[model samples]
Target: MTIQLKQEIDKVYEEDYLLWLEQTAEQLRQKDIENLDWEHLIDEIEDLGKAQKNAVETYLRQLLKHLLLYQYWTQEKDYCADGWAEEIDNFRNELEILLRSKTLYNYSASILEATYQKARRSAFKKTKLDIFPSECPYTLEQVLDLDYLPE
Candidate 1:
């Protein structure tokens, strides 16, 4: 709690980040609240939450893109459908892991519409096709269903 101790922790945070993380964990585990690096710890925690939400958004966008391509890009479907399906499965699996947290699941649902718009644009850009719908075609339930694929 002394000025010198705070300065030492700050120096470690700047010069040796891994060491600072270890020290921070130890301090937290021991409930040494006085010695905690409050500012940096708060920043790191916020960043972690953002990272999780960002990851879910990314995966959902990718899944939607591939789904669009696979279902509607008939010209290339024969050649690329299998690869697209595989990518969809991969993204879905990644999403499943992240969405296990109820907070993150809700976060994903909250962003679904905006994320769909982004994915729609990406699909159009990639295929240079005008067939994709202006609104999202898949519901969250359908999108998350492992057994579901558009006919």
Candidate 2:
């Protein structure tokens, strides 16, 4: 098939993304470059990478927020404290899986400070206690550690 055939189903990207994806892959596998939807295919591939990186940053941000709250919000500790710890654990586990890919690993590591900064601001807002440090207190390794808790 020619790229003309791919263009015939151009609307499929918005109407039936799965079919568009399948057709795109078929074009690649069959070496039908002439029929390939170059622009949308490149966009989808780039978006997929961005989505993965966003997930990593989101989980890392949550983990950092909960850890900061658990450690620094000294006055508000109560029945919910354990829940915060559990969230930290959950985020760490999710990140562990997401970070297994080398690209994602580096992506996550690179954004640690930005994620921590965002989380820290949110943590401060949640706790309303200005006692936390100006910078991230936990290292990425420490944040991911199941055993580590701030003293």
Candidate 3:
């Protein structure tokens, strides 16, 4: 690609992302290698991976938070149990759907400990409970189990 074309492509990416997307798609479909925005395309693809990783981690963290509330924090159980249960269900369902992306599923392990720690801290903040185990209480499978609930 000429310097001018490359600059234009980069400009479109910043000024009008939709146009950049359409142009990129057309370029790929037409196999116009000369005009393709290689750098931006590479960056976008890498960003997609990061986005998927972050999304999976977010789901895991949320799942852990609700599970912690449901399993421990006994004082507010009467008032919050049903709501917490519903949230646990929602987060699990979301994780199941997200896990269909193989990248997210494979990357789950890398984020598990951090996600659990964040969940523990969040639950601790709300309940002022200091009794939570130093480690995660549930395994990844247990958290994702549709039928599992802490007792």
Candidate 4:
């Protein structure tokens, strides 16, 4: 199953992998690290998590493997140009550590916000409940407004 999922991801993002690598390297070259939007990357990671939640660990391992390969490929050329190799190596090490620590499921607020926006868009397309939903089964405000029963 893990192998099959890896294959699927490889097929789906084969082009994206290269694009991300190029974009990442370019961002590094600009030395605008502080402005790099890790949130967008985290959202992609979260999307991967959603796709493979059933096999989170396996998916993360495969992702880490692919990321390391990407780093290697990107760094292999001009390996000695302005410490790029070291930076790529550091990224590879960090990816490995993240995979080993099973931290892929952890997402930042921006990631959640992006994901939620996507979900909301989908839900809106499906039904009007997205705009006006029914009342809650246990409204916290209502309960809080009521007097408590004797303990």
Q: What is candidate 4's lDDT per residue for 1-151, written digit by digit as tens?
A: 3567446545544557776656656777998666444555577768776654434333323322222232333333344323533443443344344434334434321133333344344434534333412221222222122221111
lDDT of 3: 0.88
lDDT for each residue of candidate 2 in 70-150, tens digit (9 for 90 to 100): 887777667668888889889988988988898998887789898888998888888787777888887878987878877
Candidate 4 regions off by >4 Å? 1-17, 25-31, 56-151
Residue lDDT tens for model 3, 1-151: 7788778888999999999999999999999988888899999999988887788888899889989899887888899999999999998898898899776887886678888999999888988889677799788889889999999
Model 1 TM-score on a 0 to 1 scale: 0.95
Best by lDDT: 1
Candidate 1 lDDT by residue in tens digits, 1-151? 7899889989999999999999999999999898799999999999999999899999999999999999999999899989998998999999999999999999888888899899999999997888988888889988999988897
Worst-scoring 10-residue span by lDDT in model 4:
142-151
What residue runs in model 3 are displaced by over 4 Å at the alpha carbon?
Answer: none
What is candidate 2's CA lDDT for residue 113?
91
Model 4 global lDDT (CA atoms, 0 to 1): 0.40
Off by over 4 Å in 2: 1-7
Per-residue lDDT, model 1, residue 106, is 93
Error of 4 at 116 (Å): 28
Worst 10 residues of 2 by lDDT: 1-10
lDDT of residue 145 for candidate 1? 92
